[model samples]
Target: GLPKSMSVLRVNDLVLAAYDSGIRRLEPRNGYSPGQQDSQQFWSAGSSKCQGWDSQGDATYQVLVQEVNASAPQAEPYYMQILKTCELDDATGTVQIATRCSLNGEDVLHYRGDQNRWFSVHPAAWRVAERWNQAAEVFGAMNHLTPQQCQSWIQSSASFIAQQTAQPTGHMALVPRTEARPRRLICHVTGFYPRPIKVTWEQGEQDALWEQLSSGILPNGDHTFQIQVSIELGQEGAGPTEHVCVVRHSSLANTTLRVTWDSQPTVQTVTMEIVVGCLLTALGVGALGWYLRKK
Candidate 1:
């Protein structure tokens, strides 16, 4: 009677396990696997207990399905989903847990971890929500176990988490000068992980302290991050002036990267100048030869 049901356990964005209809389903994905002894033991215990947990879940789902069918025979297809989430704030050492349920893509019930109460989102589910709230022991046990399970999972995945760090590559380019606006220099740092990074402009040996703008760190498709910093040239003129882009990130060996840009003539400009000079020289030589022959 239950419509298609699936459950997933995740840490941050990585999936640890997935189940469909109380049966474990395995597929290739960028999921975590335990390598350390402690992690291995934790994984083994959790996996071994999953079978019993699934059995209980199957029985509960059957009851819920039958109840729904009895109540609403017209709505033949019904979907019931349960989501349990535990979020941790590393800086504050705070953990927040939530238990939520949805029916046909609409939230129907939510458990308030702080207040220890279940609330109905849909009017029709008010009775069901009240019934759940009356059974405090069920949700209470889940609330108590969630934080411990999250911490254990975090500890088990520490090594794999650490391996997620990635180093960044940086580049510097000059924005084409325009009649309406001043020329600008842009520094792009890409393919980095663990987010926190600093980018600045430098002139000579010190910080430029010029007006600049930044595109805050953004995630890449490959799970890395990128950022861009740009500074106004402000009538620096055509003369050669050196500017440097300094980057600091944890992934770097020395935690620092520098890219330099100078206002020098481009290859195309230099080549054009050479061609013009040769043409002028040839014309001058021809004019002088004609003058001598006529004289």
Candidate 2:
């Protein structure tokens, strides 16, 4: 479980980082809900989708590191990516970060599960948002994700996205709880053209509750892009029959994929159970009365 007080504190810290980085108006944060992973988001704003425009105006910026690991025993591209995430809401901004070690078009190390926070605004950002997350830094440290390296990756990602047609395909699921941890609903999007995508977790047909996350656009070895969002299912009360993972990409605008939790007791089912219980109770009473009369 996350410390309730720290998520906002962490947000303040990242805010300071962005401010120090010369981003005057760029805001960063996910929807902050105490101890709930899904309710959180990276506090930046922008769109990855290229709507026939070379850039996403002033809302978008990029920092990336794509350098070959000079010391790796095998050939691979070690990459670290960061992006400002935007969503359906009119919030200010939030940043997203991700790292990977890919070889021959496949990720030798892909972040998933509890450690699975990418494009998150899904998982807690406080844990990783600081110092670009030490884990990611450690991975990038070997590859030398210096400012120069990041600049190269930024240029490469822009060039690749410009010339590519990879559109993100998303998979949504509720992961079962493990060892008392809450279950997480994860939306994994992959194979997208041009990498800039808006993955939103929506409740009931894009209702008032929605979350925006960033996967920071990483390569799939096939010249494609992949990203993900995850949130913890907190003490749900047979809840939220309607859940969806909405993927807005340049190729498929506002594309949505509905997701559901495991079989929860529906209202109809609960009513039926109550009715059966009452009938059984009545039958038992009737039998007891008849026996008393016979006695």
Query: Highest lDDT: which candidate?
Result: 1
lDDT of 2 by residue, 91-147 (tens): 533222334322233233323222433322312222333334455433332222233
Give the local distance difference test score of model 1: 0.62
Q: Give per-model TM-scores.
A: 0.53, 0.32
Taking the tens digit of each residue's C-alpha lDDT, what string does model 1 give over 1-295?
5324444565644455554543444332345676555656755565555544566655545545554556665555655556676777778767787777654455666776777677777666677667777883664223333677777767677677677777877766566669987777777677777778888888777887668998666545445667778888875653115678888888786858887654435645644643554455455434323221222
Q: How displaced is residue 36 in candidate 1, in Å?
A: 3.8
Deviation (Å) of 151 in candidate 1: 0.8
Whole-model Cα lDDT of every candidate shown, in order: 0.62, 0.39
